[model samples]
Target: MESDESVSDSTRPVDSGVTRLAYHNGSWINADDVCLSSRDPAVTQAVTAVERVRAYNGRLFELDRHLDRWQRTTKALDLTGLPSRPSLSRLIDEAIARNGAWLARQKEFGVLWFATPGTADSPTLVIDLYPIDSALIERRTRSGSLLVVTSVQQPPSACWSRNIKVRCRLHYYLADREARQTDSDAIGILVDSDGTVTESSIANLLIVEAGGVVCPPSDQILSGVSLQVVRELASEIGITWREQRISRERLAAAEEVLLTGTSCGIWFANSIDRSPLRAAGPVYQRLRSAFEGRVG
Candidate 1:
């Protein structure tokens, strides 16, 4: 029998299995037992940082890179009162061990870990895991969709912790809500303060032109793990890749467009602002195949 910390009591036998793990302060507990106080500053003013790492075949993909980013963000936010890298790593290991059985059954999922300063302005951490929505993953992988929205105005590097994955994502949520209102699949596009194309709300944006494949500089976008993987795959497969500032007009005129992220992997954008293009072109097909091979 599994320990209570590894399984939730409300989890039903027929409900598709799931495992829960949580780490708070210096103790590891069941996910359900990890609670927060209303007095916590992060709860009141949203002072927290987070990173989401995806698991493929029951193993974390690009874990080191995720940890590096997580550390950078917390330190930038002056929250080093949280556990050290070694301590955090041990907790993550425990989390994986606790969830190993469920991970095996799912084949793929995501891990969300975060840290927020305590109510007294001291270091405190909260880590947990939940199953990825399989239906959403299937839909994104099989069929591409459009993002119909405007760009965010902040320069990527201007963020408080530009290199870290932080939890202050109010803007992202706003963009997503706007996308859904128009029946789009995700946030349409993000723009810099000056209105140049930056990225999609949650994914890096790429455009295929007569010259080759182009992505915006990391200076203006979140350096995504999947984006790096795609670039490496593109190079290995003989596709040209470059980083340049792209205008809205250029994106709409491109031969192809795609979004890359931890959750979505790779997805073609059939249109931008209702301008249509091929849904599954040769470049997209080749890149997707290469990426899937690497992950599988």
Candidate 2:
């Protein structure tokens, strides 16, 4: 197996010989120069609605789906004074065009939009492009991920809609920190109050049981864009997919465990809480190949 350290340099984008640009409010600025005021509500309270889109061959992938989620989140939060959907769409296009040189240096990249309630009447919007962590992706895909079931529980449905993507993720931060104490590379998986596995810090959890794909119901977890793609891919290939409560015991006995998210796409987990499970099971290989083909 190739070491992540050895693969790191190869996966990184070469110097593009151009400054990257970011969209800030109504202007484009040097990516490094964009910042929010210290007193802004987004900074002080972490009240930001966020959406991320991946670029393949310098083109945004699943853009409409991401934008739909972004709009829904802003509306659910009652955030006022946001740009119209069409205007926001054009801004995202401008952002990508402005950073094309940097994006062309890599096979894929991530573009993120952050919306927040500012200190004044209008809301705040910031858009930036980021490189994917190829080394980490390479490592996880090769050896699978290690997960530790964290003590932190997913916030109840009454607190907010499960589908809203927001920046109030202190719980995830704490969960990852707790997991690191067990294994530096281990990711923390959150469970519901009833001990049903909900999700990981930044990824959605899915398990293959009896040759079928099963994930926690949408009401119990975030409705992930990548997970939705997986669902479509599964159906296209005639693989049965469904949703249900995944207990700790069920997870341990799963035929295979998979993690899905924006940055990482779909990868399997070799162990949870240090117990070994199947790695790169047949279903994972099929879905991963389908996903890669779809992306290309």
- How close is each model in CA RMSD to the real structure? 5.0, 4.3
Q: Candidate 1, which segments miss by more than 4 Å at Cα?
A: 1-19, 100-107, 159-161
Residue 256, model 1: lDDT of 84
**Model 2 lDDT tens row, 179-289:** 889888888888898999999766899999889999899899888899999999999998899889999899888889998887667898999888855468999999999
lDDT of 1 at 59: 74
- Which ten-residue region of model 1 has the weakest summed lDDT? 1-10
Q: Top model by TM-score, which number?
A: 2
The residue pairs found clashing in candidate 2 are none
Q: Which ten residues in a row have the lowest lDDT in candidate 2?
A: 1-10
lDDT, candidate 1, 66-125, per-residue tens: 888887788787886777789778888787788666666654566677788887667678
lDDT of each: 0.71, 0.81
Native-to-model Cα distance after best TM-score fit, residue 169 in candidate 1, in Å: 1.1
Give the Å shift of residue 283 in candidate 1. Answer: 1.5
Error (Å) of candidate 2 at residue 193 is: 1.2
